[model samples]
Target: MSALLDIRQLHAFYGKSHVLHGVDLHVGAGEIVSLLGRNGVGRSTLVKAAMGQVAARGAVRFKGADILGLKAYQIAHRGLGYVPESRDVFPTLTVEQNLLLGRKRNADTGRWRLGDMYRMFPRLEERRGVAAGLLSGGEQQMLTLCRTLMGDPDLMMIDEPTEGLAPQVVAPVARYLLALRERGIAVLLVEQKLAIALDISQRVYVMGRGAIVFEGTPEQLRQDGGVRREWLEV
Candidate 1:
């Protein structure tokens, strides 16, 4: 598979404090790659840097072109979508309205459509007229994911997608991500849950002290208890 998003020697800083240190990773077309680490290890920072959400330096190439210095919106317009950990949906806007905001102008048509999002999560369709702020946590998370998809991105970086979701709801989210992969969309998922990451990702990168310590397939990671104990296990 060809690389959809690539990062090499990535470094990011929050004000005076440095967070990410030479993090290198890649997501291939039609693949799901999970970034797993303990809190504060800069997993989220790496994705933020890729999206230009924070001050970052070094190579961030999307679809074989450098996008390191582009603004967040500029990156989005380049077919790189981001769903932040906070699930930044428009609170005042209705469900459909918030999704409409994600539609890119003059973008080359992609597989996802508004009707597809509604069909994927019928609950969203039910509350199409309801304000986003009034939706439940799981519903908001769904909205955020579907909203990003509306932009027809070739690659999506999502942070903590199941952070606050109920157990039953988590399965559907995982399935939906797999569906994205089936549709040839690459996913960079930053998640805290070991089971979900292990279950869904084609490959995994373990971060320790802001750098990747291990990169391998799920089976390889599962067989290495030392890496898990040092970087991932709480």
Candidate 2:
């Protein structure tokens, strides 16, 4: 079977500084793949390049079509959802309103619904009418994830979904991601938390110096102390 997302020799730059150098990776349908690395190793850049959020060269193929030069919105319309490390929620909009904004044009289509989001995070339902700015950091993160799901993306590229949150809040995020996989939505997760990434992902890739240095099942990564020390351990 072909990959749902395929990237080959991807190179990205900001001004004249190159960030990603010949990075290659793939995500298969119904798979949860994590990109792991310490800071400044270009994990986020790889996802941004895949989403057309940065200037990049080389191939980014989605379901067999070249998507390298497409604009961000165009790429999104092609069923790829991006949840940045920074949780971006419209401050003034009500919780429900924020979710409504994420709905793709033909409302009745897609696998996810507002009710599904609420079911996944009951707090969102409780605060359905509250302004998004009033939500706590954890709540905002959940909102952002649900908002992206509201778009009904076939593949979600999430960057650091558990960056800053109480311990109680972290597990739910993992469960939600697992649920996405169970529902057959492919995920390309970019995460720094080793335990969470390893626990939830079927496969993992470790990045170093803007390139993929290792790829294997989670169990293999757990046993490779050398790679963990060089690329993941702080």
The sequence of per-residue lDDT tens digits that candidate 1 reaches over residues 115-182 is 89988898999999999999999999999999999998998999999998999889889988998988
The 10 consecutive residues of candidate 2 with the worst lDDT sum are: 103-112
Local distance difference test, each candidate: 0.91, 0.93
lDDT of each residue in 1-234, candidate 2, tens digit only? 579999999999988999999988999998999999999999988889889889999999998899998998999988999999899999999999999998874777678888899999999999999999999999999999999999889999999999988999999999999999999999999998899999999899999999999999999999999999888888
Residue pairs with colliding backbones in model 2 are none
Provide the RMSD of all predictions against the true structure, rounded to 1 decimal: 1.3, 0.8
TM-score of 2: 0.98
The pairs that clash in candidate 1 are none
Worst 10 residues of 1 by lDDT: 105-114
Model 2 Cα RMSD, Å? 0.8
Error of 2 at 22 (Å): 0.2
Best by TM-score: 2
